[model samples]
Target: MDTGMIIQHRRSSNIHSLISYHAHVGAVTSIAWNLFYPRVFGSSSADWTVKIWLLDCFTPIQVLDLSSPVGGLAWASSSSTVFVAVTDDGRAHVFDIRLCKTRSLCTQQIRQAHWPALSCVVFSPFEPVILVAGERGFILSLKLSPNLRKLHKEARGADEEKLKELERQKMERIISTSAIS
Candidate 1:
């Protein structure tokens, strides 16, 4: 089955080339583009793979294999530094585009953090981080490096404590009001 299609009209041929691409051995169901590069990317459910292609080229430039069907794909435009792909098994594969012409360096792989499937992945515009949304209403933000993760954890603890203190004050206010009445 044709997963995704793009059509181009040629004046000389008086016809259009209907190009249909399959992401994997299975059907290519969805396609995404890199905002900062002239590249196109697509994913398929049948074979659970993500393929990257140069614009106007039918052949894929790179193929990323996944253990489970792919649910989402994303590319960073800030420097064309990274490409991220998420799968049904809650695994995210991070690749470095700079090394694509030489060695295939998978910068990072996150596993078992998401349940069901990750439906979408996006990068933060203000920071070097990624946000993933998964099935069962699961939302998570993954930082590129360990330093960010540690800072995030510390910030979360502080926020939780602040919330708890606010709750305690709210309860005290209600008790005093009721006692006076």
Candidate 2:
């Protein structure tokens, strides 16, 4: 919102504008409603905060703070406990915000963006796969099994090998393209 307030509208009825005011200090950039928890939704703003709101509530149940402004935000497709937000600095921050919780905290990040600011991020409805859109004209679909617990193991083993293999494949493609040209 231009006045730093997030509003909700009712659908399929004559009624409209459910809430009169919200708690963002700057222009709100994005908003998302959880697929599983219809009463729960999220709002992100240029004020560098993300707020979790229950339906028909004026005060937020949770608020996440960041240094830079968030560009996009979305709730997990199937899980009511999961949510994520993306920023302009090539990062996607994830959170575990189940309902009736007292405090808010960030849980994880999807992955580093493609070396550019990310515009948006969405999770697949069926699986844990995530799609991230970058401002540098690219969209990356990543199958991230790199959970916080699995990350160390993957980094020590699978991830390094995969990175080497990908680098080799890129070099081969470059060489073949140069020869063709």
Candidate 3:
């Protein structure tokens, strides 16, 4: 078993420990930081769960159970509340927290059962596609449908700052609702 810890360091000083907790019962397989929100990140573990965390909290805001070992995970480049986690059983679990927090919005079978386990998943920054890699030297690119790529919309001529704030608020709402539930 491995514990998850966050650390911060400056160029002129030694690394300082921030918060440490038992994030998983098994080894953590992958960790990804949300591109749109600096304070939010996610971790997947062999315990068959993915946990979403906030920088200021020790407990995870949400835990998703996949019922199989998670090989890797990656946050979406265009949305703060969306991510994909690959499992050892050759399934790709796509989650959009804004739509549903209890389960993945969609699950795709990227590889056959006889094929090697998927090792990693990454989202394309320029498009609504994801590339999944397997342990046996195979890679598959998947194009997300319109439903999976749905994102919050801003008014016409909205500034960049306003868009960013909307993204931040979206994540904040999920976090707050998770706390209550």
Candidate 4:
């Protein structure tokens, strides 16, 4: 299977099967997993829609209406709490994936994040932080709240250990020069 494709391998027979998930009329561009439910999320290139599928039933759980072709997708770990998607038109859409039917009740949108098409979007390893990458090597860091933003800024700018290491190296260089002289 490809990087985005999910596959199941049979141990005994060494046979692999592609997990039958969604029925998309267009090419499936990206897929993400729902943290709360046994489901997978996917986006289509031609249809410009996001689809959620139940794992066991292999059926589409929901479809999100979008205007541009989807380029990337990600989900929050808090179970139907937040889902993120980027489009070729440089728009980022965040939505609630809590619904069971093929429709979402509420939606939130972020637009024009990149000048060109966006390539990928993912949640930070630290949680509540979203990382987006796009064409021209564009990258964006987004925080869910002001508190999260403060924490992220601190983490990104923290340099205590590096400073200490630099000091140690300078001292060692000085000592070596003195001994040589």
Residue-by-residue lDDT tens digits, candidate 1, 1-181: 4434443334455655555443355655456665544434444453676766655666666566666777777775333435677777777776654435332344344446535677778878778789988776778888776432233222355664564454344334433433222
Write model 2 residue lDDT over 127-164, tens digit each, in one string.
67778887666787766454511322223555645744
All candidates' TM-scores? 0.62, 0.66, 0.88, 0.60
Tens digits of lDDT, candidate 3, 1-75: 255443433343665555455688888889899988888899998889999988767788999999999999999
Which window of ten consecutive residues has the lowest lDDT sum in model 1? Answer: 146-155
- Model 3 scores worst on lDDT over the 10 consecutive residues at 1-10
RMSD of 2: 16.8
Candidate 4: residue pairs that collide: none
Compared with the true structure, all predictions reach lDDT values of: 0.57, 0.64, 0.85, 0.57
Q: Can you give the lDDT of residue 36 in candidate 4? A: 38
lDDT per residue for candidate 4 within 1-181, as digits (tens), equals: 2223334333457765555443566666777765434334444454587765545544445567677778788876432435677778766776643222333333335446537677789887566778888767879887666422232222355485653344344334323433222
Each model's Cα RMSD: 19.2, 16.8, 2.6, 17.6
Candidate 4 lDDT score relative to the true structure: 0.57
Candidate 4's TM-score reads 0.60
Using TM-score as the measure, what is the rank order of every candidate, best first?
3, 2, 1, 4
User: What local lDDT does model 1 show for residue 118?
Assistant: 76
